[model samples]
Target chain A: MFDYKLLAALAAVIEQGGFERAAQALGLSQSAVSQRIKLLEARVGQPVLLRATPPAPTEIGRLLLNHVQQVRLLERDLQDQVPALDEGGLPERLRIALNADSLATWWARAVGDFCAERGLLLDLVVEDQDVGLKRMRAGDVAGCVCAGDKPVAGARCIPLGAMRYRALASPAFVARHFAAGVTAAALARAPAIVFGPDDQLQHRFFAMLGGEGGFIHHLCPSSEGFVRLTSGGFGWGLVPEQQVRGELERGELVELLPGRVIDVPLYWHHWRNGGELLASLTRHLEKYTGRWLVQV
Target chain B: MFDYKLLAALAAVIEQGGFERAAQALGLSQSAVSQRIKLLEARVGQPVLLRATPPAPTEIGRLLLNHVQQVRLLERDLQDQVPALDEGGLPERLRIALNADSLATWWARAVGDFCAERGLLLDLVVEDQDVGLKRMRAGDVAGCVCAGDKPVAGARCIPLGAMRYRALASPAFVARHFAAGVTAAALARAPAIVFGPDDQLQHRFFAMLGGEGGFIHHLCPSSEGFVRLTSGGFGWGLVPEQQVRGELERGELVELLPGRVIDVPLYWHHWRNGGELLASLTRHLEKYTGRWLVQV
Candidate 1:
């Protein structure tokens, strides 16, 4: 049997990014936290943590973390069923990894009422849409929203509709860069705004356009900043249709290639045994997300 | 003399997150990029990169990157003077690290016109306000906006006013959590929405209120998401005054402690010898940022 106290210490250390902060969060002395980690490693018969600046979990540590996450969900289920087991009425915390674009647009609206009503708390880790699932695989999150449809060994993946993006730029940017016309070659030559290196939406768009070589791009990791940079004539980029409705309507931004859209299909990946709470949240997302995303 | 091509390869690898992608960006074969890195490493007589999943630069690599960044700015100045020396008229790229609160609120508005007019493309990296200068110190950015006023070696720091934050919550949340009145004990027990692990804004606020020990927090990394989550009644958080003006006026959000504000002093850090273009940008920020941020 695994000791939950030690498991919690490991989670706290990883989340707080240091032993001192973990101790502070856990209301324990730094030495106590360090002792707990050492005990856990001794029990496992190998090192569970990488002794680095901000400590990282080793492969075995990840498996233990995954087990801890699953056990937490199961515990939530038990607490829900037996109200007497609830400790201090602390709101349940669920860590989920999600892409930035979704968080910026419809995610809060879709889940707000549900979370409030259920008295649930969220720890949201933002990653690129293409790689959000990695957080789940690394045991850093209970669930994730990503473009990948395949599920991890103990996880289930559900289609959550698609976010449609259009290559958009400001009127001034179009007048400056696309004066000759929006061609693949012009796109290759002109600078574009990318969310981050992990974001392959622009690369996928280029692939669809049959442009081979790498294009000049300016990295702007924030979705809001991406739009602002694009509309400010810094570059053209794929903006989610839902996010730029006002911009498009106000003529602050225009389609670079009219009617050419990139629809990124999204999937919700959660532990198969994530308990009643996770199941309920999944149902809520399934019911509400269609209002914001194109049905996949 | 050092090779600029090797430095470019190093920058590309760091920016693109992998050698294959860096090679693609440079229009070179993977082997050629590998050879250049090896050659550079041999010349330095030590390992420049820590071959992690995403390669990280060693201390010496950071110094080289710093040199590369400075040279790029100086080269831009030379190109500005002698247009014939310009390569393909590619718009100059400036990498910067900044806090999310500023990016979400006043940053784009302040710099939009300047970037557009100057044809300067930005690669904006988002970091916490307290630690943004670390990016400049690591040579990952040409400049940064942070709470720290002390400059790194060979860097110049200028005060850019302060961003005022107020403890805010949705009206219903206040009614539920603070019905008895806003007290330090109650505040510590109630869930708070934190920007991230590195965000000490809430902790600082708690300290000012004479509250000790760790508080319950839910991490939401995005500024836009933070506002939406706060307004959606997830938790109370210290929100920028500029960001929540609408929510306050509309009565959707209310101050947890009225008139209590946390003013984080902002500073702009740039390379000391970053040449004419960087100096102009520094001047532009100095002239305009006060219009948005609270005068320090």
Candidate 2:
């Protein structure tokens, strides 16, 4: 059996991003927090945290954190059953990793009801769809909404639906770049808008057209800014169909190739033992995601 | 003299977050990029990059990166003056760190005209008002909008004005939590909505009312979601006055203590030698910020 207090110390250190802040959160002294970490490492026979400006967990530390996250959920379930175990009747806080596009488009509407109904609070960590699973591996979130369908060990992945992204640009951009023809070669020459370095939607779209090399691109990390840049004639980008309805209707933005759209499948991943709350959220998303996302 | 090629390789590695992607961006082999970094470190007689999963700059590395950022701006100015030096007329990209609240409220409208007129592109990195200057120190961005008025060495800080925030909650939340009276003790017991662990606005607000020590808070990192959580009766939070006008008018939300407001002063930090483009942008912001931000 593991010492739950030690595990809590480890989790708090990673979550708060430093030992000092973790100590404050835990209502312990900085020295005491450091001592707990030392004890934890001594018991494990290895270092749990890398000694850095802002400490990060080692591989063993990540495994322990994963254990702590599951324990937290199970504890919450227990607290629900035994009201005496509840602390101050504070709503449970659930850390989630979600893509920015979802947060910008339909996330609030989809999850707002569940959160309010359950008296749950969310701590959202924004990550790219392609790499959101890393947050799970790092034990930074209880669950994640990401593109890939694979689940990490001890986690379940469920299909929520797909976000249909159309290759969109301002009408002025289409006239300037795609006037000659919307071909793989032409796309390679024209500038594109990438969400960030981790985003591969543009690369995948290009690969689908048999264009396999690098291209001219501008990186814009914000979902709102991504759409604004696309419509402002900065560059063509893959934008969610749901998000661009108004722009499309106004004729401000147009598709690069009409009818050519990429359906990025969205998956909800949660710990297998994440208890009733995650289960309820899963069911809720499965029921309501159809309204905003296309069937895959 | 510093070799611009070596500097370009360093910038690309940090910007792309990895050597392979940096190599791809620079149209070079991964091994060549590694060699460039090694050569740079050898010349500097110290390590430039932290050999981490996602490489970070060391202290000297940050200094060099600051130099590189300024040089890029100067090069763009030079290219603008000498059209023959321009490479394919690609718009120059300026990365700036901004707080999410400002980004959600008034950023786009404030900078839209300037970007369009100058044919420039933006890569915005979202950081908290208190910690945004760290991005500039880490050499992650060319400029930053943050709460601090002090500039780092070799940078200029300009007062951009202020964002006024009021402690607001859903009408239902206010009635439930503040029915007795909105005292410091009542506030200490009531749940609050915090943007993140980095956000100190709630703490500052409470401190202003002579309430010290921690309070229960639900962290919602997204600006839009923060408002929704507050309006949904999850918790009271300090929200930008500009963002809550509609909710305020609709009677969905109300201030806990009427007429009690917190005005957070904002400052823009840029490298001293950031050249004509930065100078022009600085002037543009000075001319237009008064239309959006309250004078401090």
Candidate 3:
């Protein structure tokens, strides 16, 4: 069996950038850090880290670091379940990957409440859905909320319900550009605000009408900025229901197409055997995310 | 030589999700989309697309998609140089990846001004620095502004300047937490705000005085939220100088440690062969980022 202490040492060296810094983090002398690494290398018969400026882990070292991080997560979960180990210390910081769109809208407030109630801390890796799942599969995060329903090779997939999106444009924009309604010709004339090329929500909506060509498009990556730009008569966009609810009610934003909506199915992917801590966490997410998302 | 038309068809299929939708996007029949894919696969002597329910690209197909994206970027640059292809239409939308820290502070305004002045549009891929560079190398984006000096292989690295970070806390938070001076014991009691695990700026600062233990942290993924949380006296945090200058000047936030700063050097990584178009863009960045960043 691999010694976790050695793995922690290896991870510390790569993350903190040098043996001296790692030693400082571990409250050990620099010589002790070197000795631990030497001993660990003797055990594995391979050097784990490259001796370079701002040292990076070798392939094997990277795998070991991943394992160390995994173990650290498991330890946190253990601490959460068996509170006898708390011993008057703070809650362990659990890192998870999530998309920015969710974070900006309702997810943060909901997750913050849950984390606070549970006396837990969170560290988020904010990225696109696919990348978040990829990070989850790489063992970088405990779980991820993503756009797909499929679970990674060894993960559990929980359907978090679809987030319904509507084509939103300012009334002024409609007056200026799309006064003739959202037809194929009108679509060609009006500029559309897109998250990115890989954002298929617009395409899925566009396919029903068969008119996505030769249109000027603005790409705004930030959810808040996207809403601001869309609300301020910049362009038309596909915005989530929760994000546009207040604006829509206030008549600041209008749905380009009535009745028709784009629904993006999001999933929570986590290790199936994540135990009590994750199970409890997912239950809270189910309650929060389920309420925010549209009915399937 | 590969048939770019066939590759484009395949990319549309994967991106748009089905052959039928790809046909719609291309303004062609579904059968024609299938025929193009068949011909492309025949040329490669292997299936490039899996033809799965949602449609996915095979390994070779992913590479070709990346290549096509590269060619598209080159074509935009070429169009910029040739001028004949303007054809009285809108300017090209260039996709670039950059970190949130840059986005929330001065980068967005600078990029917006540059794009406006140049008659160009921008699609930003927002993520952490290393992830941004990875996307650049994979041809998912044309360029990225990121921390660190290392450029991806075959990319030009320009040292934009160092983003100096400072440990900051609200006056009320300092009064409550550091009334006993900033000791390791006090640090253990006082919570901290960090961007993520890879954000070791706090730890680097924490190590100099040496106290970091089980301190509660609120992981705010958004730079705007980070500043908001820190300024509201929720916790002490290491914020970039540019981001917190207004708050610092107004006495809403104070530096936790004076004279101990974290200088995170940021670089502009772009294709070396990006030609006159990218060169002009970089010149603007040098003017903008250089002016905003501290001389260190």
Candidate 4:
């Protein structure tokens, strides 16, 4: 069997992008990190790292890194179970990765209930749905609610549900920007909230509007922040109905393009084992969000 | 996060049904196995094993055992990929669980070319479709070519073609049992080869004959052997057409009931990871079997 410790060390080094940084993060001597990588290469029977500027992982290394990340997550879960055996003090910690929008709106209450029921200490990592798997693969989180159907290696995935997005804007923002009744031409001049460089809501909105989402943008990283920004009259956004239900009902956030909506499918991804906690959490979330998200 | 090692040990004991047996199978001392069980129970904060007759797992134990099995299979996959780093060695070992009928017929040959080209080793575990998931849950196999859509908790499942079964009998067997113009009543009186005590083909055939399959008296365990027994004049059987192609062509085996065939869907289950070896194998199997099996 391969030495899991060495593989883990190598994975950390690759992920951190430098021997010095990895060594510092892991609290190991630089030589020790270097030696571990060397040993891992020998065990693998091939050079796993591309010894160049910034040092990148080779194809085989990438595969091994995925395995190492899984092992580490499993290890952390094992560690958490240790204290539970004693007095059940220090409630088990649950580290979950999730998309910004879901985390901001529907997930917080569910997460709170999860923490309360299990007495679990919570560690939430917020990221875009597209990149949540990377966080899962890097051992940064134990579970993720993501948008992709394909799972990271060594992680388990199930369809937790999907979210529905509609083009929305603060009534003030719309009244100020588009008096010609929310056409593609009117949307072109409107400022919109962009989640990040990788965010596709703007693009999707443009596609629905029969044009591209113009560069007049306000960038917000958090889903809740994005919603708040949009509601505060910063710009238009494809807001999940659950997040802006009250605002829309009260006419604070107006549906800019009625009858045009996008369904974004979401899935639950986590380490294949230690699924009970995650399964229970899934059940809780499903009960509340079942009607809001599209069923696939 | 669960202790994979302890969970694996617990599952081993459940499968083996005794500490000694489980220890022997795992190559660990009986004391070690006992300690592992104690540790696992301690970790979960509940008793896992019943410790009664046969030492079966409790409900919680079964739940964790299921998770452990998934983890072990994924771990085996990681181990299987180790040899791929070697120069021109076998890339991986695919431990596959498949129903007897599929194994005996087109699946083996369909995958033969791909396995040969990649020098991939296959560990085949033959079982009935109903019990294949149990084998998968027990960590006996990494993937399954079975009939079902209900996924194993942590595995990825996709439809991988289907097969049609037709009732067949040797000319001698039919001639000895029935006169010309054999009817459903004649089939009920004729001795038939049931795949096993739990085999449903005979029951399905009887259902088609407007009766139940309990009418079958003789039972054979092997799919290949079942066909052989039928062709040797023991009895009639519901056989895959692919298995008895030569027999049907040479007048050795005759279709007992013409124009009546049963279509059974098949699916492939594997770890969700994008393993190249698995991807290649699945591609080859699907490409060949898609031509014969039902699309849906």
Top-scoring candidate (lDDT): 1
Standalone chain B TM-score for every prediction: 0.88, 0.85, 0.80, 0.69
Tens digit of lDDT per residue, candidate 4, span B103-166? 6555544664565455454445566666778766654566788877787776778887778888
How far in Å is the alpha carbon of B224 misplaced in model 1?
Answer: 1.6
Q: Which stretches of candidate 4 lie over 4 Å from their true place?
A: A1-296, B1-34, B45-96, B112-127, B133-142, B149-157, B196-216, B249-251, B257-260, B270-281, B291-296
The local lDDT score (0 to 100) that residue B100 gets in candidate 3 is 74
State which candidate, 3 or 4, has the greater lDDT: 3
lDDT of 2 by residue, A92-210 (tens): 67889898888767776688678767777677877875557987766668789988788988788998888889999888788978898788898987778888777778888888889
Question: Between 1 and 4, whose TM-score is larger?
Answer: 1
Which residue pairs clash in candidate 4? Answer: A77-B1, B203-B213
Query: lDDT per residue, candidate 3, A51-98, as tens digits?
Result: 875677777787787677666656667774686864334355556787
List model 3 lDDT by residue over B174-288, tens digit each: 9988997887678766768777546676777777787553345667777755776577666778888887676889999998778788888888888877656676888888788
Chain A TM-score of model 1 comes to 0.88
Q: Model 3 Cα displacement at B289 (Å)? A: 7.0
Docking class of 4: incorrect
Candidate 1 residue pairs in backbone clash: none
- Native-interface RMSD of candidate 1: 2.8
